[model samples]
Target: MFVDSRRREGAAAFRHIFHVQMDGATSDRESPLMKYNYVALILGVLLILLVVLGNILVCVSVLTERSLQTATNYFIISMSAADLLLALLVLPLFAYSEFLGGKWTLGMTLCDALMTMDVMLCTASIFNLCAISVDRCIAVLVPLKYNQNQFSSRQLGLIAATWVLSLGVASPVIFGMNQVADRDLSTCKLEDDRFVVYSSVCSFFVPCPIMLLLYFWMFWGLRRRRSRTPLKDPCHRRSFCSTLVLALCHAKSLTDSVSDGEARTQRREGQRNRPKTVMRSRKASRVSRRERKAMKVLPVVVGAFLACWTPFFVVHVTKVFCGWCTVSPTLISVVTWLGYVNSAVNPVIYTAFNTAFRNVFHKILSRWM
Candidate 1:
């Protein structure tokens, strides 16, 4: 029975491959399509360039910025490293294939290696993202107990684990007995439909859902904790610990006081008498409380991951799970490059959202500029 089942599975895979080859040949022979190829080539090149420069900024900012170079930031560095590898290893093939109207000139070994890297890096990025989210949930929920020194070692262990797991799922492409098959257009790819489906599920589908769940849970936990514990800072006289919220609230009260247009004098007096202690204390304690607040920076890192990776994950799910899927060669090329765009986006997200990262990034740019 097992042998029969295997035989049936093999036959189905062969059919899938046969269809793919036929589709490639039909697409190739039907038209010149040079204009479409040119557009695709331009877009792919842009994505590659963006990914390279953006990731570099992120790495430089994290390393050079003393404030951001924490244990949690170490995980960020690992994530960035994975993104860099993705761009380096995967984007060129995607660009070339799309530019030549889905033609593949690279040999069989390269095809296998490229696919492996594509799957491995993307999986690793998502895995690291989930890890970052979990780390933040712990840090935010238990700020007092979350020490960087203690967490750093564990974060490194998690980063290592992500790579191992990613490589494990991607192993079949590199080492499985199934050999790369040539398409009608001479492009080589994994010919085993079962393995392809399995890898896609393992790499994209399974990991993404889990990451989404974790992110939702983390946000809910954060909201709950935030509501339960009123912001308390002995040094600040404001009702809220959030400085921006307090500022906005203070501004609104002033606006209300002035709405009469007759209380202009009173409004000026009120502003004069408004306590300066909160502002002074906020500034004064900022430097002193750096260490105290640094442990809570995990949220910033996780936020970066969420922003950079979410679109790619969403688009991928649409491609893999949708019914009657028939992606154009150009569209596939675009989405593949878009995935690489996530790699470049991670560093940009970090630098843009994190204050410490921004400062560090500015400093690095200044040195070069």
Candidate 2:
């Protein structure tokens, strides 16, 4: 009987040990999840800060520097403002939701507001980029007529229209047209397929194609210019030969004392002005080189925009169209954050491409330092 009792005790002990082991395993799984949550929280905060600061710097630099206050840079300023709005109004809420494991504690009205702002600001940003591409294309293709004054008013009108259109795209939510009424209150998303399609087309599909076409035309113009450059070399050589012959004739006249007194004075004056003319030509060439470099950097901006936003938009469209396809929440979060990262990247691209922005940024930084 005692042996049987001892055996029962051992069995109970084994069961207790098994329970303890299972608990430990569960805790082990949870620890990594908790660690991940902490990491995500930290990263999200940093991203918000980065986006805010970078865009603010861009706006301030443009506003303060007269050189950057041109018509082309007004589009850039608008882009920065859109990004700043996104970082301020959208990102904090997103970060909070992310930290809470995608559960939005914010109310439904705020949820709708957040989603509206998200769609509106992002759409505006993309449209601003499209405007920039169009502006650059015109500047390259029609240099003589690309006056900033002629475009300034039109650009302002276009920027205003861009926001109006963005608001129109996002207006359905405010009117209760496309809402996920029965969706989980813990999560806020545009669940209506029609609204998704509309928003996607307005924000990405239409604008992306237009941007691509403008860039293609711009590059085609550039290639034509480059190919014709060699042809211009022969004309330049002929002009040089003509100028040399004229100079030789003038020298012969001077040597033969066939030139009048007034002519000798005129020749001396021309010799004195030649160095100044060469200096002006060299300065103009340098300016042209800088403009070309800026032009080259623009494609990089467009390419970066495409790369950063494509995956998010692709997954978004797929989710809307494929009802049965399941996507992990983590994946959605990653792609959403990826899109936000573009806001941070933009000012960096501006600083890299445009020397004026870089100089203004340095001046701003120096004041603080």
Candidate 3:
């Protein structure tokens, strides 16, 4: 849905797009904009396919793979469901409208429904990420109570709350708030300025910081615990083994009536081999910083979400208050599609580091291949 020049209500044609021409207003097939639309249409179709495939893999992997059946992965499955629904329920019409130059050919009913689902699902995605962060924080700060990856009532409650709160945020659209007297019939977008602002705050502003802080606390706790109790030294164990081997060699020499000279040679060999054992022990005990990097899916996921969505809410809220400011239609469509890209991007980036999901994904995909 898009907003018109009058700044009145718009519906599901990505509603915040302001100053778009009416339907069939631009029919120049050979024009640059038409060529651009063609490219966008192709890309949009690929994006939909990717989102569907990737999210389906996530859901199936979590359901079918025993290793992925954990509290954290359940949250991921919920998040993937949101992205998958966005692709199935929302993006086709969104891309069609973009091709139509922001004209909402779909009836007002579908437009309203699409707009509601769009807000709810996008917000639900953010909420699920926040929930995952919260779950990780709990596992870090209170390990014994977390039950080592059990899906408890608390996790269920969090997932339920995520959807319910998202619905609450978007319920106003369902209540005919977009049916204003001066609404544009040609374009569909969000109708109420207050709703745009409210949804923006609820979806992005509130949850993003919570995710960031929770991840920060989790890392801090992990580092602090590791610092309090350093890892055991390996040199002591290696030295004991060396002495036992040397004593055994000497005892065998005595049993064979071997001379002290030959026993001293074996003892000297043990002393010479001690440095290699110490080096091997040290290498085995060394910790890599990549271990910390491997656990950084939190930052990557949250950062991608924010990178994709921040522009959208920022533009929407800015358009609400700064009516005099001139934002290009191209910019609006770019940001809107950027949000759509997030649905595809999240499933890929979020599960990229998860070995269980990757293994299951390979197993499922291998059957088709």
Candidate 4:
């Protein structure tokens, strides 16, 4: 009886251990969080690929194309470089952070460093755009004063200053102001919501509003001196040019018809010798009309800048006020990716308004291929 009882006890213990192992396996196999993380990983990788390719193309085209090597082009190159840095440094880590499904695995120090880079590089790009706007505004307002030679050194100095100031502002956040993984939950980021808010405010809020005000003033000044100013809306400039070309063609046809009629009448009166002189005089008048139709596209670009960046500002404001408004991880990812996508669109915007850039791009591409 004792032996039988011991055998039953051993068999029951073995059965319990087998059941526990099955349960552990089931838990490991069916985790929803793991599935979601896999999705985030795939999506993040795709977006990073797009950003890398697009920014690299912009940089390469600017460097290779002679027409794009101007001071303005250099600023554009700076902007593109910043964007590429963000994609390389910030986006991949962000994706990995998400892969942990909001759980940070890379500890705190690295996280703080990445957060600092994101803030600093992003600020540098914003200030760069603002500088471009100011330079373009100045160029349009005082064409003779903005000699490319004189403007180049000043622009270079300002670009350097932009980098120095960005680093200065961002250093505190990375150095010790921010919590490290060694101290807190082993994750790096702008842990203080208040600090994030302040940083964004100082970087985007203050500078962006000032930029808008300056742009508005520039537009007003342009309008006030309308008679002396050439066309500045790059988009409008193209439309105006096309219209002028058609109008000139129509006028030339009309003048030719009138001249032919006059010559016919003169021939009937035995004086058919003045058509060449009359046609030459009309051609000179047409040439003068064409020369008066040059247009500048800086204002159009200002409008585009406002449109592209306004949504981000609005989203930031909504987040500030509605602190409890839970945004989906997916939506956050989309908005953040869209913000990065801005770098991709800028070259296209320049091509749309600036004929010289377009022609240069075409020549470089053709030659390379």
Compared with the true structure, model 1 gives a TM-score of 0.66
TM-score of 4: 0.69
**Model 3 error, position 365 (Å):** 1.1
Query: Compared with the true structure, what per-residue lDDT tens digits does model 1 show for residues 207-246?
Result: 6667667656766755674465436754454532454454
Q: How would you encode candidate 2's per-residue C-alpha lDDT over 1-369 as one tens digit per residue? A: 999999999999999999999999999988757744666688888988988988899889878888777677788888889989998999888888877778777788898898899999989989988888877777667654564354466688878988898899888877775466577776888867788888899899999999999888877876676566555443333443454455445655674555576566756655556444544434434433444666777777778888889888899999988989998888898899899899899889988877788899999999978
lDDT of 4 by residue, 1-369 (tens): 999999999999999999999998887887745555887689778867766766676688778776566666677787778878888998889888777776677867787788799888878878887887676566546644564254377788878877887887688777777863445564445666566677777678788877777667666655555554346633224443454444445445554557867544544433223333334433433332322221245445445555655566556556667979976656655666566566556666666777766676676667779
**How much does each candidate deviate from the true structure in C-alpha RMSD?**
16.4, 7.2, 13.6, 10.6
Q: Rate the local accuracy (lDDT) of all candidates.
A: 0.66, 0.79, 0.78, 0.66
**lDDT of model 3 at residue 87?**
92
Of candidate 4, the 10-residue stretch with the lowest lDDT total is 286-295
Whole-structure CA lDDT of model 2: 0.79
Clashes of 3: 13
- TM-score of every candidate relative to the true structure: 0.66, 0.76, 0.74, 0.69
Tell me which residue pairs clash in candidate 1: none
